[model samples]
Target: MSFDYDLFVIGGGSGGVRAARISAGYGAKVALAEESRMGGTCVIRGCVPKKLMVFASAAPAEAAQARGFGWEDATAGNFSWDAFKVRLDAELNRLEAAYTKGLEVAGVNIFHQRAHIVGPHEVELADGMRVSAKHILIAAGGRPYLPGIPGDDLGMISDDLFLLDRLPGRVLVVGGGFIACEFSTILNGLGVDTTLVYRGDKVLRGFDNDLRELLTMQLADSGIHVRLKQNPARLDKQGDQTRVTFEDGKVEDFDAVIFATGRAPYTKGLGLENAGVTLAPNGAVAVDEWSQTNIPSIFAVGDVTDRVNLTPVAIREGHAFADTIFGNKPHNLDHGLVASAVYTRPHEVASIGMTEDEAIQRGGVEIYDTRFRPMKSLFAGSDARVMMKLIVDEATRKVLGCQIFGPEAGELIQLVAIPITMGATKEDFDLTVAVHPTLAEELVTMRQPSRRHEAPAPA
Candidate 1:
């Protein structure tokens, strides 16, 4: 059948833009539709801008430490929230222009309009323009979920945080997810009276138990009041301030409230129903390993599919989709060994593979863990410590996971992910020679197993 474009991709996020560019490179006529900028969440509101704020917040901490280190900076400069916000927008605009230029150079047609799936093989734009393609890809990504509560409209989601004209005087951030911790870290570091409330026993509930505990203590020390086992029941507006009521009959006042509880797939108005696409219980578009929806012509990836929900993972998935559908090379994404990082105060947590809890649940698991203060931290007068854990299967001696909470934990975890992805054994990590004067060496040199054969070795 004749098609307007060989491949028409909706949502100019990481997956959509990559798929469109790659498909076009393979000599296919490709058209990409984006209701907003092309860089998606990572470039827009999720990672890039968030990390920049994290870096900005770190400056004050560093300056405070400089006096003790004999670096004489008698005067400290005040950081302006207004100036940072303006500069952040300028940088984001530059990135958006770069993305647009990249797509143009790749010879892919770009559409700045909301796209809806019209049929199994057709998509309609907001302007009522319809395009029929041989294959339609939906990488529209996801959105922040705001709970139904009184004055929830006064609060901001992760997206809305970037658009704020003024930094909040005080922020009552509710949730325990990675996003919640991250926002709290940034706001607290920037001198905002930040209070974090989570319904769980601890923040970062799914992360390594040791790391979570260590971070909780560190965050408390950093002046962030972490209220655990409690969640917001309602938000009341009291003049210019927001008062949040917790389930446990606790109320706190703040200039703003940010709900980083979770994000939902942004497929509500995409017309997925008309195209015969199915959504999972989590409200994400259901897709097979091949990224193809129930209808073969329609495919989905990135946060929309609820698989991994990481930027690099999304990029790889998009590449695999383009290779399989357009280049005739089939590839499936392996979620195992996906590395993730959480930038928190006093510690940065990073991990790949299963957590200790997950390994123990599987049964017959061994854990080799280490906790120590780094050499630099000792002289730096920091009382913080680093924690590392390796979960291995007793039968095969294969390392199932690696988790760390320390300085440069993200960098250390990424290096370990390589071996984990290659199915490296515990012995492989143990045998690797340690690099002296480094924090990560503690991970490779973990000799004393924390948990080994709970009862006895299998006969």
Candidate 2:
């Protein structure tokens, strides 16, 4: 089949960009189309900017802790949202340019327009240009989702956070997921009266229960009003404030309301149906182990596939797809045992593999749980405590999961994930020498199970 290019990629997010670049490196004629920015959600609206905000938000707490170290005038000063926004925007611009430069250097044609599938092998751009390819890849990613309720438009999504002109005086964060929890802590630390309201009984629903409980306490200690089992029934704009009516008919007003309820795959109007590509019930593009859609010529990766929605996973999926189809190196991404981190103030939460709940459901499981005030926080007289937990399969003693809640928990989990990914067992972890005088040492030193459960026999 004669085509304009060997591969046509839609959506220049992490997945699409990686696939296009790698395919081009393999000497395949490739082209990529991006409707908006090059770096997509992670670099532009998500992880990068969110982490910077996390860093910015921690200054106040750090300053107060300096008093224990003999620094007198260490009180945190007023934060200027305007100043931070300026620098953040500049950094985003620089990152976008770097992505563009890399794509160009890789010999991938860049189209600064929205592209949609017109046929299995054909894509039409926003500028009325039609491009044909032997294969098409979709990596459109996902977007913040808001429920359909009265006056819901009064609320903002996560994407709108980066574009806010000024920080809100009193903010309400809606959702139980990591986004809601992280932003709640961020805003609270930045001196905003932050209230986090989730419909569920707890925040971080799928995480280890101990970690969730510890984070809930830490969030409360940090002055974030945590309201569980409540959802916004309606939102209305009253003057300069947003009036939120809860499901129980309780009303609260805030300067701004942000909904981090969930994310929906960005598959709307992409012509996937027209191309005979199947989509999941949640609107995610349906794909198999190799990220190939029902139509073999059309493939999808990243959040659009609704697989493991992490940015790094998406990038890996993209690389694997390119290698398999273009580089003659067949490979597939293993979605299991992927580590993740949530940036919440006063403490960070990170986990890999299954949660305690998940482990319990599988079969016989053993849990090693520990909670204590770290030496640094203890010496500083801070009430903050760190929680470390390990879930192991009882039959094999293989570590099924690890969860940590404390400073550098995210960084610690990355190293911990290496052994876990390599199928390290509980005995192996105990055999390792502990890194004394460190919070991570607890992972290696815990030799006793705090709890054990045996799954019910097959019915």
Candidate 3:
């Protein structure tokens, strides 16, 4: 069928950009439309900027650690939000420019306007222009969801936190998810009085219970007021600050209230129905493993499809889709077994494969878990302890899951994911030589299962 391009990608996010670039590389004419920024959520708001803030916010703790290491002159003074924001904005601009350059170099036409499906193979931009394509890819990412409460607009989401002109003296962070935990840590580290309120019993509700409990303690130890089982009923703007009324009928005032409750798929008003596309109950675009929507001519990837919502996963899905459709390589990403990390204060949480609970529920599994204060943190006079857990299948001796909570945990889990994803066994891990004096060595040296559960008998 004759069309405007071989592939028309809506939303210039990491996923969309990758699909567009790869499809163009395969000699398919491509065009991409982005209503906002070219780099999408990761580069512009979510990961890149958040990580930068994580680094910036850690200055105080790092300075204290330096002092503990005998650098008496090291001091953690007041953080200058204005100064950091200037540099941050510049870096984002550079990244946005790079995204634009890459798309241009890849021969993908770029449209700096909103777009939606008007037909199976047609897209209508905000300017009333309609373009048709042989195939369409939707990579429009997710949007941060705010609680449907009074004066919710006055509360800031994660994106708004990054754009703040100045850090508040006292801040109230909402939700039990990683976003709420991480930002509470960031604000506390930046010398703000931070209080975290989550309706759940603990933060990071879906992670391993051991990690969750320890992390909650670690967060409290780091000086964040952890208010569990509590949620803000409403937010009211009181002069320059915000007054939050809790469900318990308690009231508190804060310089700002930030909502990190959760994010929803960014498929709103895309007119998917016009294209006969299907959407999940949660509003995510319904797609197959190959990212193909109900309409054969249309496909969706990234958070829009709500599979694995991580940036790397989205990129993989996008690449897989482009390869399958344009490069004669029919393949799809294995949505399962992808590794993830949460950047929280005092420590990081990383995991791959099943949790202990999942392993217990599935077949049967043995668990090897250890906790100790690492040498580096020990020398720095920090009380934070490191934990490493291995969930193994006793029958096959294969490691079912690995979770690490400590220094360089993110890096450690990345490497651990390699072996776990390769179907490495507990014996295989034990066979490897331990890196002396390293916390990760525990992965190889644990000879005993702290607990074991045999598989349930067949009915």
Question: lDDT scores for all predictions?
Answer: 0.86, 0.92, 0.91
Q: TM-scores across all candidates?
A: 0.96, 0.98, 0.98
Candidate 2, 41: how far from true, in Å? Answer: 0.3
What's model 2's lDDT at 16?
Answer: 93
Q: Write the per-residue lDDT of candidate 2 for residues 1-459, one digit (tens) a residue.
A: 699999999998899999999999999999999999999999999999999999999998898888877787898798999999999999999999999999999999999999999999999999899989999999999999888889989999999999999999999999988899889988998899999988877789888887888888778889999998888999988899999999999898999999999999999999988888988999999999999989989999999999899999999999999999999999998998799999998889999998988877776999998989999878877978899999999888889899999998999999999999999999999999998899999999998999888888888
> Which candidate would rank higher by TM-score, 1 or 2?
2
TM-score rank order: 3, 2, 1
Alpha-carbon runs more than 4 Å astray in model 2? none
> Model 3, range 320-346, lDDT digits (tens) per residue?
988999999999999789898889867
- Which regions of candidate 1 fall more than 4 Å away from where they truly are? 72-76, 453-459
Model 1 steric clash pairs: none
> What is the Cα-based TM-score of model 3?
0.98
